[model samples]
Target chain A: MSVINDLLGGFATALSLANLMYALIGCVLGTAIGVLPGIGPVAGVALLIPVTLNLEPTSAIIMLAAIFYGTQYGGTITSVLLNTPGESASAITTIDGYAMTKKGRAGAALTIAAYGSFVGGTAATVGLVVAAKPLGSLGLAVGPPEFFSMMVLGLALLVCLAGDSMTKALISGVIGLMIAMVGIDPVEGAPRFTFGNEFLLDGVSFVAVIVGLFGLSEILNTGTERPGKVETPGFRALLPNRTEFRRSNPAVARGTVVGFLLGLIPGMTGSVSALLSYGAEKRFSKYRDELGSGAIEGVAGPESANNAHANGALVPLFTLGIPASPTIAVLMGAFLQQGLTPGPSLFVDHSELAWGIIASLFIGNVILVILNVPLVRVWTSILSIPPAVLTALILVFMVVGSYTINFAAFDVFVMTLFGLVGLGLRKLDIPLAPLVLTLVLGPLMESKLRESLEISQGDFSIFASRPICVVLLLIALVIAATPLLRPRRRKTRSKENQHEAA
Target chain B: MHEQNQAAPPDRPSPPAGPGPTGPPGPAASSALAPLIGQAVLALVAAYVVFTSFGLGLWSHIGPGPGFFPLVLGVAMLLLALSWFVQERRRTATPAAAPAQGAATATEVPEVPVIPGIPSTPAAGTGDGSGGRGHVLAVVGSLIVLGLLIDLLGFQLTMFAFLLFHLKRQNAVRWITAVIISAVGSVGTFVLFGAGLGVQLPAAGIPFLANLGL
Candidate 1:
């Protein structure tokens, strides 16, 4: 009852004209960028963070969160219409989505995707409201040792799940941590890696690094690529037919449940969840035989899963201050920039803001469905703009956005340096998510470790002594060792079974 | 079996097949060398980090100093890089067997199985490799110019020049289109961010542009 009343109060705050306007703007802008190939929500949010510098914290966060989910909705348009995923998470949709377009059912495929996204997003938001409070309360009882161990678990999960190569991910993560340590040490105020520069005192700007890596690197890579021919099919009907709706109903339900559960796990992002859902649907759907040949369920399931996974990602950020994905990691940077720390205390200290943002997510979903369904034609036109113009505009925005961080040209130079580095990393197939995640969490881990050591008089056993710390460390160990152990175990089992059969 | 059939179809355009931007796909030989070079760079960086940490004092009377964390990280990074180097060398040594098998099957299928969620296609016009490098240099060079000249020419002029150059050099836009885009993008962003959003942009530094305010 209290949760319901608080949500109602949140609605009152979110309904204000100012907040509503920001939500609308975020939704529109998020869709615009999300429609563009090669630019995902991470760069979209990073580019807009400077623009929100003047807004109040609550409104700023509400707008940013809206953009996050709005991009998920927008990604589907390109996947279905052009067979090109607007974001990586939308990749699964291209199989059946593009097939549907080929069969003259693009409108139906898109409409089902929008509806499924709404259902998934709304359900996950409800789960976040129900789960966040209990999780936050649990976090409030954790000490520094436990917190450090938790961060270790988070990093382990990221490296383990990041890509095919664990070593590359670890190297990327270490580089990010090293970058985080470049400025002055938090405890002793001693400079570590600044190399005698004044800007080194404040550390590398998160905005500068992100915009360079995601925004600028993307432009450089895409600028030389040949543009594909995008065919904009005329819309016949906006809603799915009755048969099509019924076929996708169960897939939407299953995707919502699967995506929400997977999303709660640290380091499991929307891309992973959507991929898993697509795999599950391929096995379980009644139309499985036709899945890759324009089945509506294929479009419905992965689209819902991606959106639900995005909403599910917010739970950890709100409760324990741990970001579950790269987008959330960048959002955490935004929180820190606003002079607010995310964690259990945020709920108690700024409950209104927390609840208001949650409430705005609910409103944001309705706006996304309406915008994606009715206004999708407008978004498709964005695809027709010359890639040259788009690339140039993105570069200009990257420069302006990084410059606004400190009004320093040096930051732009730093951004350019990282842009080249990012280009190199991308070519090598190194996942950027783990790097971004560790960069945000590295300082927190360091500070917590120091505090734990201080409490135990410099004894290393303090990390193992606490019950929560022990469990978290154990989890991290198991996560890291699982990949190494699996192949060996399978080989051993196969040999023993062959011996028994012989 | 059905799932495998759906997931592993050879004719389907793999997730990475499209020419949308994310860099040109380099040849397999170059890709093999990339990780080797990357690990080497990582090793060097680790060494520098370890060398620098000694000045910050690893341990203090209270607990650990600022250097303690970075030192630990530096050592771990070094070990990881070493392992990566060893693994890459082993893989490279065994590549002959795989290439023989791959070449045997090469004519049966033209497209490789796409790795889900990773772009696989090489950029158009980059198959020869030289064009791709030139594109990269052009973009990076423009960024350098923009960074160096932003303060001297002011935000609008610097952006205008950067856009115009990139559009002409890399994108091959017509002269008129490039000019129109450069003007609209630079001037429009200036008004939107400066006047509307209240960001303080650098004023024109050139004497002639400054005097033109009259």
Candidate 2:
């Protein structure tokens, strides 16, 4: 099959010494970001974009993409040892993960989690390889109308699935669009919201905004709490027993399936995939009752799903040029920065680059397993870092990161302003994911909508006239309507959660 | 509002448990109408956008001009923010909805594996959780100063002071430890990124400082 040959070609490109080193470095830094508090992958990757300015596009993306997936495995460490889920997908793991820590089986739980993430990521990469060609072809067939509709669906889904209130999420998305409109009118040469500042010409630096939004805001939010040093206890058993392995295998399989499938959908977040994977384990695992306790299956299933979901989310980005999550949107921003638009045309125009990145993903996953297993002690030691010291260092990095973007002090100011904005949004529980995705997609969506209208001579009927556009729009409509129709589910779920907490 | 000031624990019970504050705060007087303030502000922004779009040009025979998309977004924002206001007003009327509204924001505390980030990470702290406002103000103030002074004092000296302030002032870190860390972070980072990677962090602006090779 041509797929085999193309993949082989991809391996040849990926096997280059420079590409391998980049992958190794990406996985390492990605794990650090995951383990380190305050810097999320969105900000971490965004922070590093300036550093990659000198590299070839393929190597740059390969490294950034590795950081993206590397976070998946890194979050599990805190979930198990510190009773802190480094990320949301790892949140479920904290139940059994911490329980295992309590039972002094922390090492086994961590090992299983790492292995599960590897299996899930590897499996999902296979899915991407198999599905990318067909999906890219399908994406190529879409016209401007359909493309516009597809973006609508993505945004609608993002808003619907974002937060407790769809209204807040919608507001966040709209704000993102507004922010995106701040620079020059990409269509016309006139500036809209710049207020006549030269720095506003390129729009707010994406790197500055992102670092401020995700990174600095976090520092402010947790600034008060001085995390006292906690000693990491030594591990009892480093690897799972035979029974633990047997129990984990099926959950890994189930998590991979759930994560990959959910990842393929428009609005599914890693948290959703992990949550659903947890639900599946509860329903089907023979040891389901032990889920809340120190059960390896609990640690394995969701971590696997979380990592798989991460890689699966890439399918949409690679094939359709649509970022499935906020993190992916940031990655897409990186792609744009590299002067490479991610979409079907990428495959045709730069198959070697595309496949090279794909091959690097699998390599990244392997490097993660190899590196993380031996580095667990080092990773755990990161948690022992004083919050004050860590905060200071992170702040310096953020400052340097923003300054290096265009060597502009204006960007540091922008980062500070958005940091305050980020704090306010978090305080109000406004979802940032929708804001991020909309921000990244705004220009493209605007351009596509304008092009479609141009083709139709300003007639709006073209959107409805096309079957794919109609169906995509309908799907968007349905997703938007879900909360309105099932208001009780939303209320009950929140209430139930509140009651359980109480 | 003060109740909301108390940050949420790292882990909270939810349909899918997430980390972060669940909502705004408790029903302070039940009619605590803070959400409305945000909605009103957003509505005003939307209105401004709509007003400004007319100047940029709207739809044309050749199709959408630059303003058309922003116009649509601005109008949609206006309507949506208004809807949010209405929703909040209705919830304010319902006493039971008050508490739920404050807690309903916990959908995912949203740690979507997409970006395994730091959110609600202080639950492990054994210290008394207090006095965040000062720390936040200090951080913000210092960051602004960094931005303003980086071009003048240069990256190394500015970062040295910034890191020194954070390390010493925040936790009463030992003066020796603080200086060592700050020096390494500033001078060391400058060497790694500026010299090695050729990132070109700002050199001192003053003639004397530049001559000193700062």
Candidate 3:
């Protein structure tokens, strides 16, 4: 009953003319950027942060959150029509979505994806409303020791899930932590790694690094690759047939559950959830044998999962101030930039803003389904623009975005430097997600650890003394050990098989 | 090691024999060399951090000081680097019997391509090849030039020139198309960000443009 009243209040704020306008604008821009290759949600959000600076906080966040999920809908169009995933989460959709397109069911695939996304996103929003207050209240009980341990666990999960190589992921994470330590020490006033440079005083701007790493570096990478031609498919009858609908309904339901559940776990997000859902469907579905060959369930399951995962990810951000993915990390930065710290106090201190954003998500998801279903042709046309012209336009935007942050050329230089570093890392196949996530979490972890030690009089046992802290630390330890043990266990099993054969 | 795997298609079977001299180095050699270089550099950086942290004082009366955390981070980094070094060495020493198994293992693990939102097909003709290297250098050089000249040449002229050069040289777009695109992109952004968003962009430093009222 309280949830209903709170949601009504939230609608009052979100349905206002200004917030709705921003939400619509975000949906349009997010779809536009998502349709383009090399510009994903992370870069799209980073590039738009500067544009949102002038708006009110609620409107700004409403638009930003809309963009984040809007990409999920937009990405599916490209995957179905172009066979190029607009983002990583949409990759699984391409295997069967594109197959459906090739078989002249592009319209059905696109329509089902949008519908699945709507279901997943709406369901997750409901989950968020029910789960957020309780989670935020739980966060209020977490002391510094528990917080520190939780952060460690978050980092561990991130490292475990990031890329193929745990070593590379750890290296990237450590490097991010090192970068975060560059500015003045939080406890003491001493500057750690500034090298006497004045620009380093405020530390490396997170937005600049993000734009460079995800945006500028991507442009450089695209420059090296030859562009592929895309054929725009006609949109006929934008509704799934009865048979397709029946087959898709169960997958969508399961994907929603899987996506929402995985989303609650810190560091697991759209890509992981989508892949896991696709794999699960492949293993268990009645259409399993036909999954990669234009099965509608293949398109339905992952699309739903990715959308649900996006909403699920917001749970940690709103309640505990922890970003579950790179996109959310940038969003968290935006929250901080807007003078809102996303934690337990956020619900009490800025209940209006919180509810406004949540309510806007519901409205935004509806807007996306309507917009994307009818405007599939418009988005497909966007892909017809020359890659060269698009690249130039993106560079201009990147430059302006960085410059507008402080109206300084120094930030542009920092952005350019990180761009080169990002290109190098991408070449080496190191995952950028962990780096960005850890960079955002590093300071929070440090401050919490410092406060915990102070409370315990420099005794290390405080972290182990608390039940939550102990459990969190144990989880972290298990996650850290899993990658190491798996190969050894496989080796032993293989050896035993050989012995039995002998 | 990661680089070599990224260079090849995920599902492509490894050759029975190692790569020849005319071809790029085999995965084993490249993997060993790259990690060796990366770990050595990381170790050196960690050592510097450790040395500086010691000077800053790792402990204080209240609790761990600023240096204490970095000190622990540095030591952990060094240990990780050392472990990576040992792993790469062992792999390189046993390459003859490992390449096929390595390929199988690589295929088993899902390699999410790095583009974040979009899962692109394996980039066409992109790797650590010289052509790719040249393209990267060209893009970086243009950005550096833009950063250096933005104030002096003014934002509009600098951006126009940078865009024109980047399109023509890096992307191989026709000169006419490049010119039109560059002009529109630079001027359009200036108006949107500078005028609409109220961001202050540098004005044209050229005397003729400044005296246009005449």
State in Å the error of residue A250, model 1: 1.0
Alpha carbon lDDT of each predicted model: 0.80, 0.81, 0.80
Question: Candidate 2: where are CA atoms >4 Å away?
Answer: A224-236, A488-502, B1-33, B102-131
| Per-residue C-alpha lDDT of model 3 across residues A378-422, encoded as one tens digit per residue | 888887776666777888889888877776788898899988777
On residues A1-502, what C-alpha lDDT tens digit does candidate 2 reach at each position?
9887888899998999999988888899889887764567778888888877778999999999998888878888878888766766677888898899889888888889999999999999999999989999999998888888999998898788776678888888898888998888877677878998998988889989989988888777766344334435454467778999999999999999999998987667888788889889999999998988898889889999989999999999999999888888989999998999999999999999999999988889999998887688888788666778888888888898888877899999999999888777775667788888889999888889888988989999999899999999999999999878667897788789999999
lDDT of 1 by residue, B46-140 (tens): 99899888988988888999889999999999999998888667645565322322232211224453897543765322322423667678877
Could you tell me the TM-score of chain A in candidate 3? 0.97
On lDDT, who's better, 1 or 2? Answer: 2
**Could you tell me which 10 consecutive residues in candidate 3 chain A have the lowest summed lDDT?**
A224-233
TM-score of each: 0.91, 0.91, 0.92
Give the TM-score between model 3's chain B and the true chain B: 0.70
What CA RMSD would you report for each candidate? Answer: 5.7, 6.0, 4.3
Once fitted onto the true fold, the runs of candidate 1 whose alpha carbons sit more than 4 angstroms away are: A486-502, B1-32, B96-120, B123-131, B170-172, B211-214
After the best TM-score superposition of candidate 3, give how far the Cα of residue A8 lies from its true spot, in angstroms: 1.7
Report DockQ per prediction, comma-separated.
Answer: 0.27, 0.30, 0.31
